[model samples]
Target: MAVIPATWDMYDLIQGVLQAPWYHMVFEVALVLLIVKIYISQSFSPEKTVLTDKEKETLVEEWVPEPLAPDVPDDHPILKSMEKYCIEGQNGKYVTVNGKSCINLASFNFLSMVGKKEIEDEALKALKVYGVGSCGPRGFYGTMDVHLHLEDDLAKFMNCEEAILYSYGFATIASAIPAYSKRGDIIYADENVGFAVQKGLTASRSHIRWFRHNDMEHLESLLIEQEKLDKKNPKKAKVTRRFIVVEGLYLNSGDICPLPKLVELKWKYKVRIFLEEAMSFGVLGQTGRGVTEHFEISPDHIDLIAASLETAIASTGGFCCGKKFIIDHQRLSGLGYCFSASQPPMLASAALQALKMLESKPRILVDLRENCERFHQKLMNMPGVKVIGDPISPIKHLMLAEPAGDPGLDVRTLEMVVDNAMNDGVALTVSRYLEPEEHLPKDPSIRLSVNCELTHEEIDRSADIISQSFQAVLGKLTTRSLDVSSPLNSVQQDNRSLKASR
Candidate 1:
């Protein structure tokens, strides 16, 4: 309120103009006006009109509709089969399906421990203690002490330096492959390897050379080709790793890989060997040590072995066995291991129980081997059915002695036979394949799985039922219908002259 310096007032009341010392005040006024102009323009500018919650939802729904999966028709063969043969409760040597207890030739309970009281009790104990799911991956407090114990049990069981568990059987080899093999690496795989193996190879983005199924000669030729390629580019060969991928027991064909030859090639070519033992782990060998034990080869020769516990072990999940360096790498580098939750503690506990049970009862392996051989011999005597697999293989494919000219007809015939067998209280499966995806499509057949619990009576009954079913179905059709071009081929007489008999 100090009234002074009125002389500093630079205003022209009469002329409405004049400023020099008060230039700062004028500049400030201009700055305030500019800010007001900017605020006015922005405050009223047209952006999109804001939508209400319901309007926003409607717009989103219209713009991005939820997708529906392709419908599988009710009349689909697979669905029809499922509807006809719905197994209730646990699968075992004898499974209850559609209210009938039938001899099971369709289950994977090779060692017959699926519903054992001891294993169930052990699983329940773990379930109560650790709950159901592992809930997260190994590093995230998902892994339990039971999982570690099971890993150790598996490692020791396989006679390997270490082992790692996968929450899923399919993902075991899938994760193991890409963990080591990458783009630019070369993988030599069998033409009949399972779809999971194909997926792993595909994901690795490696250069894959496929050999004929279980053919050592073709594999050696591929190796020789690789050797020649190496000679051509020693520098690239030095940096590039070569891997030989094979199945211990080919799931598609039921034949074991020629391991000794593969091992020889592995050393001769300096390539790593990765064997997927999903089908053979608990079914092969005098002591069930798998293909390695069956052939008297050391597990050390193979770089890694991936197998599922679902087979002979009769449990959930899978595992990889090898020296510590290889398996430990999977812990961090394998996407399946790093991304999927740790296997349920209950499953790990049951697997551990099964492993221990198998160890204690070495005779279980002996029984399985004998049962497989017995079943194979029975199937061999079967007519109109060509048994395609190793004599000792627990999994065997009984293909048509002569293929029906039409693939669809052949499948329908096999499916009919399967239905007939099931009706007679013999549970059988017609082997299925995603033919479009298989490297070499497997021939249609009735797949038979032999379990240790099967007695001589059960085996004989199953074999008899299968043979009868085949005879019932195939005997109705003419050799001509089956497209048989045997010595009885007719000529110039047209279609009518093809004789049935006099």
Candidate 2:
């Protein structure tokens, strides 16, 4: 509008040229040519381009490349060494990779309820009633009637005043750790706490110290150190509250917490204790009430009792149950409780049913514990194996030799062991210690979790598979010198196995 500059004259010149006779003629011709082209290629027209069923089949046949299956390498040391544990499942027995099925020794179905018709029927009914998802976060619209019912049932079953649920066991730890402690709090935890709990603690920016796993003396020393610090910094500190956390049972070594001694320490030091009973809930104690009851202690002694519904409950979710005040405080304080999505209705329903069954029929707990003991006895009797933890708990672990402080097994080798058992129709989790030092008998060690569902025969067979797997992977190394290096060298021979182990 303000008299365009000479440099802008190019715009007008182009506009004038485009508006000339030739431009219009070309545009008209181009439009006609496009129409003709589209008419000639009617198969590719917008209205007709999609393929018919016959054409799609023909194209698929013509264009799809054959899938090349992965080949197992010949002369592979791992294959040669792991041959025994390379098993498959068949006829209800866990089979070797060569297809010899034996009794299953590896399954997490603790109550042996997963494949039951009644359980399936209940699950189906719940699914039909609640659909597949909760469709929203618990803080918004996710909490259904089922969620509340399960929470209430769990609290009652655990003999606690309150309980809060999370999507999974680890999620509970991740959400709860940071929620309770802060920058200035001192968190004294057992070395065996799960990774998720550590993550939570790390996020909370608290001063963290690790006591030896289940070592009451070490815990006392840590408590003394924290007390000394507290007295030293009485006037100028960030915030206060000493949190002592440990697992009710150690998953790696299949061991239980020293509840009496730990509780005593807590009483003397006046420090709070958080026990993650991922494996112990619904299985330990006289009434299936867990370590709190097993030790004849009340919920007041336990500042927090965190557990995964994935284990004994035969469902998916996690919860922390304790005193109403602590539970309520944690509800607001835990990010998982306040922010994360709650468990779905079907899972809640199933968990509630499982909890009710565990509570009313205490026989289930007895059966599970008996099954665990049976398995422990069977495995410990086997050649080249050492069993850890209380024989009565369903957490029998076969400790193996590491050879010169070298941890002999890793995730992949363990996975191979799992695969071998799975191929044989048994499903079990292989727990490899995070550190070689931890695998010491006095320290943490590699472990396998046993539950009640397995029969005596199944336990015997599983022990066989485990021993075979260890022997297959570890060769002739003695379980005693697993504290040495032979097993490490054996594992190192197979590069792929080594990589997988990590």
lDDT of 1 by residue, 373-430 (tens): 9999999998888998898898989889888444666887898898888889998888
| Per-residue accuracy of model 2 over 1-502 as CA lDDT, tens digit each | 6887996789888888778899787998999999999889847446558789999899988996656986767854455546645554331223244555444444445665554455557778889998988877777888898888878888877778988889867888777777778887889987767666677778889988888878889889888877787788876543588888887776655678888888788889888888888877777888877888888888778888888888767778899888888777876778777776778787787777777677678887787778777776776765544667788766655554342333334444555555555555455555533342342333323455565656676677667776676666555333423543565455555645656798
- Model 1 lowest lDDT segment of ten: 486-495
Clashing pairs in 1: none
Find the candidate with the highest lDDT and give its number. 1
Error (Å) of candidate 2 at residue 472 is: 6.3
In candidate 1 the C-alpha lDDT for residue 205 amounts to 98
| Residue 419 local lDDT, model 2 | 57
Q: Model 1: runs farther than 4 Å from truth? A: 1-67, 479-502
Per-candidate Cα lDDT values, in order, are 0.87, 0.70
Error of 2 at 10 (Å): 74
Candidate 2 ranges beyond 4 A from true positions: 1-103, 402-405, 408-429, 432-446, 464-502
